[model samples]
Target: MPPTPSPSPGAPGRPPPERRTDDPSAVPSSAVGREFAFEKRHFDFIVGLIHQLAGIALAPHKLEMVYARLARRLRELRIKDFDAYCALLESERGAEEVGFLVNALTTNLTAFFRESHHFDHLAEEVLPELRARHADVPRPRLRLWSAGCSSGQEPYTLAMVLASSIPDLRRWDARILATDIDTHMVETARRGLYPAEAATGIPPALRERFTRRVRENGDTRTAMDDQLKRLITVKPLNLLEPWPMKGPFDAIFCRNVLIYFDRPGRTQVIEKFSRLLSHGGFLYLGHSESLYGVSSSFRQVGPTIYRRV
Candidate 1:
């Protein structure tokens, strides 16, 4: 079934949200003969806090997803049910759990070169122009931001593409700043290790150029070659908060990150991104999102690609 958009918190919703699924992994419910206490009221409080904290709107249908994800937290903290979880979130003591909660509930689906066309455009069009424009300067500066760089794929891809496409990559002042709201993701990205399977999506030539295999205890892992790794800086950044780094970013890949935000929040982020761009710099969005009715600062240049006007 298609995922439907439900009303926001404080609006009318189903009476306690009845759900049916045969998936054995589902949590114990407050329903008949079940132990789960995730009633409508509990869900509203949790989701409302998510909105307030991260500007992500949780649809009513996400009750199961929320419960499944956060149920582990309850187990880890030895809390019994959703009611207690909600209380802890509201209390002064809840500050730390808030981070854990956001980490748990946030969705991160990413892969290297997941949207191949964006990298193609960068290699074929964007980098060449930036290189020519900066050639006359003594210290050429290039900045790229992977604003929601989950698990490092996007930034690592950017690094690889830049290394291959730019003629004098090392001489230029070039860096890819990859940031994510989830602390764990930032750490994982820093490690630059991936299971062998993750390499399949990456093109063979780029993979051969930029990655190497490492073996530890019979596990063969693919690691980003240091040449590629040196060009990236990974750190935690909450997009809703003020960004610390000054930027005239040559390109920014903020794909799939804005869908979680409400309209006003998305608009604010788009404007901020525009300000960060170098004149005529590129912004890459997820395929499903668009700038229509959101902002006029950018004009579409390709599928899911936009350039600052």
Candidate 2:
């Protein structure tokens, strides 16, 4: 696929109709006395800032969500209004608050095995190939990356597949790098625990083998076992920034992450991934995402799965 130029703000092309952040007609009379009125200007500033910082394209209609999440930061900082909060963000020290804002605004909905098919593909197809390719080496070295590993489920799932696929994993050098832009999410993933209900998507035997039952503050939960924990490392990472690791990873799982980015941003990330991926490596994206017209670095090997060309 040929590379495309990034779109200018308010570009001439007829873009998709933006979903509005709020409905004026739906506003109740009782809500009129609110202290801070989130104006169109404030929303636009936020969208631009987030796009600049994280390469995430905030839809125009997500104003309500932006207002609601950032309101807590405003309250914490005792900022008088949305205008004042935005002005603060525009200031020099506003850089410090960027992480807080991102932590609050970014979505982190994930599970032990949210997309079961991806794991199945990894176990049945990808892992066997990796094992066969590395079989000759005494201590086979393998690396996998989970780019938007929200709360660590994706990497842990990958680790589970590795554990099940390869016999005598202790003799091999395997590592899964799990990273997220949200510091809070990275910390949560580092803790390696989840509510019992969050384990529903996990297969019964895998769940039994990997998570140990536990209780905290009268709430029953599950924690990743040592075997899974040893195979993974959780770190804070903003995908827009430079990555510190020099990796030729065997597989890179970046599912659902590109949905938040504009076309050019998506293309840029894919190209970067292409450079990081080893020959014949795999790239797994979300069901809704595709490589079509984005990059020719990969060939579609399955639904939402791509192999490096």
Clash pairs, model 2 backbone:
20-61, 21-61
Q: List runs of model 2 lying over 4 Å from the truth.
A: 1-35
Candidate 2 on 1-309: residue-level lDDT in tens? 112224357522222233364866443344376556666666777777777667788886787788778877888999887767776765788767767877887889887777788888988998888788877889988999999999988888889889988887898989999999988999988888999888887889989988888999999988899989999998888787778878899999999999999998898899999999999999999989999999999999999999999
User: What do the candidate models score in CA lDDT, each in turn?
Assistant: 0.85, 0.83
User: For residues 1-309, what per-residue lDDT tens digits would candidate 1 score against the true structure?
Assistant: 112234355642223433454644343443445345566566777787778667788897888788778878898999987767777876789778888988998888999999999999999999888878878888899999999999999999999889989878878999999999888888989999999989988889988988889996799999989988899999988787777888999899999989999899899999999999989999999989999999999999999999999
Angstrom error of the Cα, residue 286, model 2: value is 0.6
Off by over 4 Å in 1: 1-35, 216-218
Candidate 1 lands at a TM-score of 0.88
Q: Which candidate's lDDT is highest?
A: 1
